[model samples]
Target: MNEPLCPAYSVLRLLSGKWKPAILYHLREGSLRFGDLRRSLPGVSQKMLTAQLRELEADGVVVRSVMACVPPRVDYALSSLGLALLPLLQQMDDFVQENREFFPSEEG
Candidate 1:
């Protein structure tokens, strides 16, 4: 077969997961504490969230900051590259909103 697509496939691989898009979507709002992120995604487990964050960080799309205080606060925010995806994400959101009727709802 032809050589597999490089960067495009790579990006899709990086962002393809049940939780990665959701995680990225929430981060678009700004940096958030781990607890806050977890709260935003009610069904994600702590271990899964940690793993996804680590993966995103490794992929250069997420930044993790830790404050060396008594409680040792930790927060996550998007990197420049990740921020670049916002407009695309917003467009995707708009498309979904505009075409909601075509998508099946869980309640149904």
Candidate 2:
């Protein structure tokens, strides 16, 4: 079998965590504040969210902006590279929905 190239491997490494894809998906709608993202992802802990956001930012896929105000405000949005993944992610979502039988549910 042919080995995958380094660039593809790097992207996979960046997106390896369970929360990464969901975080990316949420960011698709537009910028979201830290608390907003946390609320959207019900089960994610604060630490995990922070870690994942940092990772995504480091990977150049997500942009983090901090606002100076009465209370500190942080927002996350997809970087250009990250926005490029939307169509692909949307296609994947459609595929999963269309092929639901192929992916068994845990409840079953």
Candidate 3:
């Protein structure tokens, strides 16, 4: 019997969540203001977004910047380490596009 298809489980151990991918996907375009990110990701509660952002920040995949202003604006963007992941993410996107039909969806 084949032991298991995915023998390596540590990778999943590092990024274990539903929203991380969405957050990363959003950062692919470049910097986004905190409110913009929240608006872009519909259905994500403030609590969840805050939690995911904090986790990504801790993982060094996202940078948080605060601009001095009357209200002190905050922004998020991919860091050097985060940019390093672009190729991998883009490759994944390409692969999915190449074989998208393998996974069907209700949405057109």
Candidate 4:
């Protein structure tokens, strides 16, 4: 019989995508327009970014707001839930940094 997934697994699933953690990390500073976020993450495709943002918004981890303007602008920011996750993300970053020698360098 199959057992239910653990709470940690659920959290992992919510932030599983390659770009989700980075997206959250960038948003930790403050809200950013869609174009700005896209520019910040160089390798992400527009379509992928859109999809990920939508997923995050749906998951209640990110908030998307539309501003009235000549051309309507959309901005993304971390929700309370997302903010709560920052410390965990930072801990993960700290662990990885502390064990840097175990991981392969990006230059390889």
Candidate 5:
């Protein structure tokens, strides 16, 4: 890459965690409410999702908004930099699907 990857590689170091990619993939579809994301992502615990989101927010890859309302709403969405990563992530998803059977489940 850039002699030895860009400085952003440092950002990727944090954002490249397991749930981080999944979270980013979901946000690529559109902004999602916290509950919706928790539900969409299959086995993630509330604590893990919250932690990953906070880390991504700190890396400037995602944005978090808090709405002032009776119930109070918060939503998560990708920033421009995050959006730029979508095509690459989509490619990875497709490749995974093609070889999905290779990755067996632990329950089996």
Candidate 6:
């Protein structure tokens, strides 16, 4: 069946994962090793982080590079496609700050 397409849906779909947003935010700065990335996002299990990274890599949003060394270290960075999302994410951050009253914190 043919269905009407919504542009924003695609963007939303790409970022629907719980960890995707945070992952992108962290990668916005630059590349990070698996261990460092894991440390940045506390409470995230290794399995979950691996899965999320694979998804982002598959989506062409993240670039996974393996170093040719004794330990064979791997680093994850955002591709050009992922970089495009930075501005949008910043806008969302700004919106949240502007309307903080709409969102309540636990310590309210």
Whose TM-score is higher: candidate 2's or candidate 3's? 2
**Candidate 3 lDDT tens digits, 1-108:** 665558545344335677777887888889999889999988899899999899889888899999999898999998887787677668877988899889676367
Error of 6 at 28 (Å): 0.9
User: Which candidate should be chosen as best, given lDDT against the real structure?
Assistant: 4
Candidate 5 similarity to native, TM-score: 0.78
CA lDDT of every candidate: 0.90, 0.90, 0.81, 0.94, 0.86, 0.93
Consecutive 10-residue window with the lowest summed lDDT within model 1: 1-10
On the 0 to 100 scale, the lDDT of residue 42 in model 6 is 91
- What are the models' TM-scores? 0.87, 0.86, 0.80, 0.93, 0.78, 0.91
lDDT tens per residue, model 5, 70-104: 79999999999789878877887788788989866
Candidate 1: which pairs clash? none
Positional deviation of residue 19's Cα in model 3 after best superposition, in angstroms: 1.8
lDDT of 2 by residue, 1-108 (tens): 667676668667867898998999999989999999999998999999999999999989999998999698888999998998788778878999999989888566
Candidate 4 Cα outliers beyond 4 Å, as residue runs:
1-3
Which candidate wins on TM-score? Answer: 4
Backbone clashes in model 4:
0
Candidate 5 — which residues are off by over 4 angstroms? 1-8, 97-108
User: Every model's Cα RMSD, please?
Assistant: 2.4, 3.1, 4.5, 1.9, 3.3, 1.8
Each candidate's number of clashing pairs is 0, 0, 0, 0, 0, 0
Q: Which pairs clash in the backbone of model 3? A: none
